[model samples]
Target: MKKKTTADIIENNKISDGIYSLRLKTELSNGILPGQFIGVYTENSSRILPRPISICEADEDKKELRVVYRVSGKGTGDIAAMKAGDKVHILGILGNGYDLECLKDKKNIVIMAGGIGIPPMLGLAKEIAKEFGGDNDKQISAVLGYRNSDTFLMKEFEKYCKVYVATDDGSLGYSGNVIDAMREHKLTPDIIFACGPLPMLRGVKSCAQVADIPAYISLEERMACGVGACLGCVCKTVKKDAHSNVNNARICTDGPVFLAAEVDI
Candidate 1:
């Protein structure tokens, strides 16, 4: 919950057209958790305020953090223009992130992600692999999908766990979506965690339901106040009771991570 302009960009460049990864040297971001995000301002007084980007990887020793983003609009286009030594304003380790505690001790863990949805999964998988030691026989599997092979971040993820990949254009691992790939493998994981576009999540939820396995989904929404005060990121859930104090929970506060069935994303 701190606003710090105390660092310089170490490196920033195109990982692909409209996709870039930046490394920043910042002490304050060392303890960032997976699925948490940073709100960054491209200009000192830009009219659009700050844009929220997912925290991809963190190295406490070097006090380095990485954020991989897509240039979908003006704000992101500006982010793509940043380079080494640039000074930027960042407020973060913001929002509620995924709970690693819930994942501990599970015999089988499966992680599924799509597109830019892949970043947080990378953080999560890295932690899991570190905890269990990088063993090929480990009961961990990661399912990653992209629009095409050109946008894939495969090598970064394969180092830590068993991986399955899907692409819409048939340029990579499987010719269909991730859900299709999952069906092909018929995997029955003890715990499944996912983050992706809403439609993809919906399909994942159904698959998890049919398998009767627990699933967690990290919701990605357009956030105004990364904190909950602005009431800009409310999400509907099935947990609501007629007498429940709050029917909708703020994604910035109550969760960006929620039980798959509870979230209406």
Candidate 2:
């Protein structure tokens, strides 16, 4: 159920080079889950297509949704130029988010994320803390990957999970990738939730498969409609999708979040 709504911008600030964190006051926050995304329309009439951004944080009580994105093109550039009082049209609470119920019985939970993927995990971690209570500190942990020491949302995550870092240039924590960080720290999880670039997801898939741990991943893709109307954001799946009767699943509708076992990516 996607509805087009106008939202007021609370704040739009730079998180780092090329990355911006945006928070909007919207009514569409009721059923939002960890991995869902929204289609944000640009003020420029020339750019009819909206930018599909992952929901970094969804505050149902406050009716606020936070989205962190990298300004890669003209569309996002236009969005970055928006200010506090600006209004934007967005279609949202879209995409199937992470399912946390199934992981409840698991003793240990680990969240793995990289780069912009780190934002959503913050919300997920907070929910995980709420779901598990005081035991969260011991049972949950996060393994985050970054290009360098410049990182955003580190303190926020520390409030919910034990944090570990991995940087490419050895500037922060581990001198390798996230998988390397996990390996070095010997941080094992009964279940894993992850989001990042395709390569990082592949590495997580390999690790999950080898260790026989249940894992879920949030995927990123380019979309035209930002809804299911176009077949633009389809991903390869292991099983046939009942609706389309094919091996492809729409990332916008079917998921941005999916079980690592079900999806090929």
Candidate 3:
């Protein structure tokens, strides 16, 4: 269920260049899932549309949710100016998250994330570890991709699973993209979950198809209304909907998470 509430900014800190981690104390954090997102209202009155950010970590005990976002435009810039103790309107635990039930039987799980896409994978790693007993018992591997070395959340991922990094400029772990790192390291997994740019997701999809591994991908799209009423964030799918009789799916409502084979992208 989604709720519209005012959440207090518990902490808003910059973790790296152009990237920030924002933590909010809200009741909505209780039921948030790994690949779900929250719609945050920014200070820009000129733009009424809320910016949708993926949930990084949800602490039900603390009643808080964390989101790591990049400062891309006016809306996000306005959000970055907010400080601790500040309150903002948030509507969430939105979107369909990853289906972990489908992955329970799969022993080897590979989580691939790129840039800002890395945050959601953190919660996923922790969930997988907790499910299987502990980090040591699970074959969970996190393959992360970044432009350079000044990356955030690497250490956090290390706490839950084996971490492999790939940087574009060779300033970090592996010298190429994450798929290259995985290929070179020969880390084959029974299933894969990925969230990143379209190109990266496409590449991961191709690799997973060739390897015959089940894969899920979280997509990011421009949304005016986070609910289904707007029809603003639709993407072409491989299969048509039974009721709507269309081959398009909404990123905000129908998903943010979809099977790589189902989506056209």
lDDT of 1 by residue, 42-139 (tens): 87356456788888898999988888888888888887788799877777777677777876666778899999899888888888888775544458
**Which has the higher lDDT value, candidate number 2 or candidate number 3?**
3
lDDT of 1: 0.80
Q: List the residue pairs that clash in candidate 2.
A: none
lDDT of 2 by residue, 65-136 (tens): 999988889999999999999999998768888887876578788899998888889889988888885764
Q: How close is candidate 3 to the true structure, as a TM-score?
A: 0.97
TM-score of each: 0.92, 0.96, 0.97
Say what the RMSD of model 2 is. Answer: 1.3
Order of models, best lDDT first: 3, 2, 1
Candidate 1 residue spans exceeding 4 A from truth: 134-137, 239-244
Q: Which ten residues in a row have the lowest lDDT in candidate 2?
A: 130-139
Q: For residues 1-265, write the lDDT of model 3, one tens digit per residue.
A: 7778899999999999999999999999786679999999986789788899999999999999999999999999999999999999998878998878987678788999999899988988888777774644358899999999999999999988889999999998999899999888899888999999889999988998998888999998788899877778988998785546799888998889999988988
Reference-based lDDT, each prediction: 0.80, 0.88, 0.89
Candidate ranking (TM-score, best to worst): 3, 2, 1
Per-residue error for 75 in candidate 2, Å, reads 1.4
lDDT of 3 at 7: 97
